[model samples]
Structure formats: C-alpha cells, structure tokens
Target: MQATQADFTVLFRLLSGVVVLPLAELARAFPDEKLDSDAEDAWQSWLERFAARVSAEAREPELRVAEMKAANPKYIPRNWILFEAYDAAERGDYAPIHGLLAMLSRPYDEQPEMEDAYFRQSPSWARSTGGLAFMS
Candidate 1:
C-alpha cells in the first residue's frame, strides 16, 4: 500500500524529533526569529506528533545556541556573491570576495551590512539558475 502524505509527514516528524530537537532547543534559547514563521510552525507540529510515537528514544535536552550553531549555517554565498567574488578575483579586486568569506565564517553575529547585502534571500540570478538551493 502506498503511504499517504499524512503518513509521510508523521514519519518526518519522528525523524525531526530525533535529529532536530537539538536545533529546536537552540532556537528557543536564542529567541531567533528565523524559525518563527508559518513554515516553522508546521515543522514544529510535525515534530511533536512524531516525538509521541518514539517515547523511548528521548534525548537529553541540549544547549540550544551551541547546538544550533553546530548544525545550522548563518550564511551561504548565493550565486550573485559567487559571481561577484569571481569577477572581483579576475579583476584583482579581491576585497569583496574576501569580505564575504569572512562574513560567512560568523553568520550569527550582528553584522548589519553583511545582513543587508549577503544575508538576505538568494539573489534573483541565483534563484533563476537553481530555484533557491541557497535556502538550505
């Protein structure tokens, strides 16, 4: 029999409870608003349902901030940044490329300028080329 979408979602939730509880705890402690969207709510609901089935697999709560940092990324270079960097490198204007590399190394920090330019959504070119793989 084919599993329904509901069934698959249930399974995904269980997996999230196993793999993402550490990430969730990190979200709570930091009060990071990134995961507070409607999409995130759906994810949390699924996780709770899944956790119900695997009661024996409980893991001790983790330090959310550290756990999140370890598991999640703060920045990813969208295609625009990559192309920009490459162009700069070709022209020997390596400042933009190096600056981006440095910023990506510490994404969670409050760098307003970095947040404005590179930390936002993937550039339009990036989305068109790969349909938003930068989100991961």
Candidate 2:
C-alpha cells in the first residue's frame, strides 16, 4: 500500500532507458504540492550522477538493462495477493494459491499476464486498508 503510482512508473521508466522519464508525467504524478523544486532537482541530479557512474563502466545498453531487470523485480507477493490466495484456500479452491506460488517463483520476470493483477501500484482499496502491508 505504501507504493505510489509514480514509483511503479519510475521503475518502468528506469528499466527502459531511465534517461527518458517524461518530465511532464513526473510533474503530474508528483505535483509541486507533493514535491518541491528542490526535491525534484535533487532527484534529477541523483539520476544524472548515477548515469555518469554507469557511463564510466561503459557497459552495453542492452546488457545494462538486463542487469537492472535482473536486480529489480517486476512483481512482488503483495498482501492482497496473499489474502486472495488464503481466502481461496478457505473456500477449498486451491488454484489461486497455486497461481500465487507460481508467480512468486519468478518475481523478476515480466509475466505480462499477471501484470494487471499484480504488478502495478497498490489499489485504492488497499491503500486505506490495514494489514495488507504485512505481505512481503
């Protein structure tokens, strides 16, 4: 529930070129009220610094993206997922539990089928709900 839409969007952008995150999209996701210019500049500078460090290593762009993707998981076992699994288990239907287990097995892979169900930011319902955060 702590995850924001912008956070997931940023991760997607980073997994792409990382240098191509649209300034307008970022500004919309994190408006001036949410993030001041100083904070924005600081983060922009941080990305630039990180890019410079990566440039120093001179790795292939594709290889760098692969490494980033390998290091960063596209999916995580969200609390709501576990809840759904457990609820299904309580109903004596084990398919959801099996699916959850299968999804968890490859947290970093781009399982596109599971994207809508699991990959994005926490749902609005989940944000106000407590205990969902208990799931890793």
Candidate 3:
C-alpha cells in the first residue's frame, strides 16, 4: 500500500507499533507511489508534532527504564537463528547454541560482537535458499 501521512499518523497513534522513520525511508518503502510537495510537507509537519508529543510525554518523571524494558523485549528468537543453532548442535558443535543462550541471557544489553551476526534480520540467503525460508 502507498505510504501516506494519514497512514503514518494512524500507525503513530497505535504507539505500540509506531516506528520512527525518515522521510527518505518512507519514500523508499513505497517507491512506486508519488507524493506531491504538499503531502510531503504535511508528513514532515505530522512527524514534528508527533515527536513533540512523544518528547512531552517522556518528560514525566514516573516513566521508568525498567518498566520500558519489561514492556519490550530486546531480542526476539528468529527462525534462522534457531535453525542455525539446531544445525550446529546436530554436528556436535555446541558453540552456536551456547552463544545464543549467552546473548539471550542479557537481551537488553548491547552485544556489539554478536550484533551483526545474530541480532539483525535474517540474511537474504535465509529467505531465498531452499529449506531455509520456512520451518521443516
């Protein structure tokens, strides 16, 4: 679907599913759709208003870091990560499993070493290759 200010405004209203995105990213997400200059200006204005609202809400002293952490998980177990861990276990190499557990143990903490390999989205190959796209 085309990305519009109304759609983004609705998404922002949800709060839980809201994601802060750049105008360029929004354009890229809906490459085929053309937005007029007025629409683009409206989107920027909406984003600014949304940001101000979020900032104002954040000023409340009752908001706690622990509460936010509890509400949101730092890591989500992806199918590709699990598949790799299982594959390694079958080959008598348990490091992958151990690494996964270690990373999950402190999900909120940044693991710079594992960020690229384990924390991000599944690689394109995982989606394109045979037997990797879906669970067996």
The alpha-carbon root-mean-square deviation between model 2 and the true structure, to one decimal in Å, is 4.9
Task: Single out the weakest 10-residue window by summed lDDT for candidate 2.
Answer: 24-33
- What's the best-to-worst order under TM-score? 2, 3, 1
Global lDDT of each candidate: 0.50, 0.62, 0.56
Clashing pairs in 2: none
Per-residue C-alpha lDDT of model 2 across residues 1-136, encoded as one tens digit per residue: 0222255443553445453343433443331214556666765775567667767876777787777777777777777778888988999999999988899898877787887677555565665678874332
What's the residue-level lDDT of 16 in candidate 2? 54
Per TM-score, the best of the predicted structures is: 2
- What is the clash count of model 2? 0
- Estimate the Cα RMSD of every predicted model relative to the unseen true structure: 9.1, 4.9, 7.4
lDDT of 2: 0.62
Worst 10 residues of 1 by lDDT: 1-10
The parts of candidate 3 lying over 4 Å away from their true place are 1-49, 58-66, 129-136
